[model samples]
Target chain A: MSFITGKNLSCIRGMKYVYGKVDFTVDAGEILVVVGKNGCGKTSLLKTIAGFLKPSSGQITISCADDLQSLDIIHYIGTSSSLKKQLTVRENLTFWSKMLDSDADNIDKAIKSFGLDEMSNSQISYLSSGQIKRCSLARLLLAERKIWILDEPETALDNDSLNRFIDIVTNHVKNNGIAIIASHRPDIWPDNKKLLEIG
Target chain B: MGAFLAILMRDLRSDLRNRAQFVMIPVFYILAVILFPLGIGPETGTLSLIAPGILVVSSLFASLLALEKLFSSDISDGSFESIILCPVPISVIMAGKITAHWILTGLPLALITPFLAIMLGLSFEIALFSSLIILLITIILSLIGAMIASLVINTGKGSVLLALLSFPLFIPVLIFAAGAIDLAIIGGIGNSIAPILFLCSLTSIALPVVPIICAAIIKWQVR
Candidate 1:
């Protein structure tokens, strides 16, 4: 069975329409890249799949042993990064750690893995743009969700950080996790990555 | 219970982190009360006559100042989104946030009213009793104000909209709070306590119900 599936998804914001009789599925160990131009509802599609936005006329089926009510198993990293500027890096990680209910072992590993230890005390507002992006991406790294929906995760990072981010995405997919990345940058993904174009 | 406690702790921590903004509310409350005597001349009878109204209005305004930030910051930072996605009810989260807001703003203003009363020439009993009444009324009014602020979270100029939405709702609370003190000063403490008790009752009913309504409105707005 597919880990995540959306059938006949349709969405409309204001008067602008965004819909098609689209059928899509993501399995356990594959990366799907969604490429489109500026106004192609890429973020909307990711939001719909992540259960943040309700499609006007469609059904989303997320397969898991848990009941439907407990199936919010997707972690979303939208364009805004959504990190509070007032909070220090460690405080921000601690907040998400508590939210995810991850044990200390996993949280420590995530902090180390993200190379966030040295800058942990710095407020997010003080971080460089690349650091801010890394701080936001750290949630995707730490969360145990089976599905990851990342929107424009490569926007403000240097080449080194972008390569490191690709490594993290590849590692997540290697662990039987599904990823849906929406970006205009095609060179970020590996050659074997599945491409889905939406206009 | 865990979710409620988490929200309360988070909000309290956030409020404490912004010490200057939080501290200024009570400071302003006290300063506003002190200024009243300067404006109207410090005649003992006149100061005594207006002290209760001054205390209640100042407390109301101080509480309102912090109300706008109650949910907007959380909503803008995506904290509200995470909370909404939690298994817990949004109403519970809203209640926790509103309760924390009251503890920070309303409670401080109420606690400082006794000091303001002494400066304004109120008797000891009148000062203490008036503080108690203001505390009760401020708790309720803060919750109602939070509800109004949450409803207008997405609206343009939310603070003004919150005031426009809440001032009418605040009339009854202001009336009972000031009236109870007035009655006490005139030697009708027995008559005053009943209105204060009624105000408390209104708050008790509003405390649980208004947040739920406001949460519903917020859900609709986000959708």
Candidate 2:
């Protein structure tokens, strides 16, 4: 059974439209790449599936490890860096860790895994573009939710960091977690990952 | 219960870390009160005449200054999305943020009003009474301001819109707060306490209801 399923989903923002009756499903223990040009509703689709944006019309169901309960089964990381600039890297992680109801012990591990130990005390505003993105990715990693909806997670990262990000995604999928990444970069795509392209 | 405490602590920590904004509210309050002496001559009678109104109005602006930052940053950075996704209800989350805002802005301004009143030539009894009344009214105004702030989060020039939207709701509190001080100055503590108590009751009712309304508006805006 699919971890996330959406039927006839559509979203409109003012005069500029993003979605049009899009249908997709993501299964557990699998990676799904959503490839599309700029302004192709890729981000909106991720948001709708993650329960951030309500669909103008259609049905979305997310199944978690425990059970199915409407659409409350996913953690969404949007294109914007969600880290509070005024907060240190550690503080930002702690805030989200608590919000996601995750184990506090894993926060340190997640920071180290993201290569953010040295910058842990640094406020997010002082971090470089890549560091800020890492902070946001760390929050996503720290969340206990099973389904991940990441929008353009590859933007503003160096080649090495991109490889590290892909590794994180692979590990998450290997652990029976599902991820739907909206990106245009082909190099990050794994061999077994399914591609859903939107024009 | 845990989620509420977590949000409140997080917000308070953020507010303290950004000390400049927190410090500016009281500084503005003091400065605004000081200006009355400059404009109307520093006579004890004249300063006492306007002290209560000045105190309440200054407290109102101080609370309003921090209202926009309450939810806008969270909304923009996607932290608000994470919050809404929590298993705890949205009303609880909204209440947490509003309560934190009151403690940081409204509570401080309320505490300092007695010192401010002395400077403005109020008698000791009148000063203490005015401070207590302002504290009660400020909490209510802060909650109402928060509700309006959440409603106008997506609007153009949200802070200005919030002030305009909430100012009318604040008029009654202003009237009662100032009236109570006026009564205290004339040795009518008994008369003043009733109005102040009534204002506090109004605040208690608004505390729970306003956040629920604000949460609904936020949900609608997100949709």
Which candidate leads in DockQ? 2
Q: Interface Cα RMSD per model, in Å?
A: 2.6, 1.9
TM-score against truth, every candidate? 0.91, 0.94
All candidates' lDDT scores?
A: 0.79, 0.82
lDDT of 1 by residue, B1-223 (tens): 6667766777787678788978989988888888888899989888998888999888888888877887787667666555454456778778878888888888887788787898889988788888888889878887788778878888768989988889999998888888889988887678687787889799879978987987786666555
lDDT tens readout by residue for model 2, B96-213: 8888988888888878888999999887777788788878877898788888888899887998898889899888888888888887777678867767787878987997798899
* Residue ranges of candidate 1 with Cα displaced over 4 Å: A19-21, A65-70
TM-score for predicted model 1 compared with the true structure: 0.91
lDDT of 1 by residue, A1-199 (tens): 7877778888888787986566788888888888889988888888777666788888878877344334456677777655667678877777666566555466566666667788988888789988888887887655587788898999998888788889888888998988999989976798767787887
What proportion of the true contacts does each candidate reproduce?
Answer: 0.10, 0.53
Candidate topping TM-score: 2
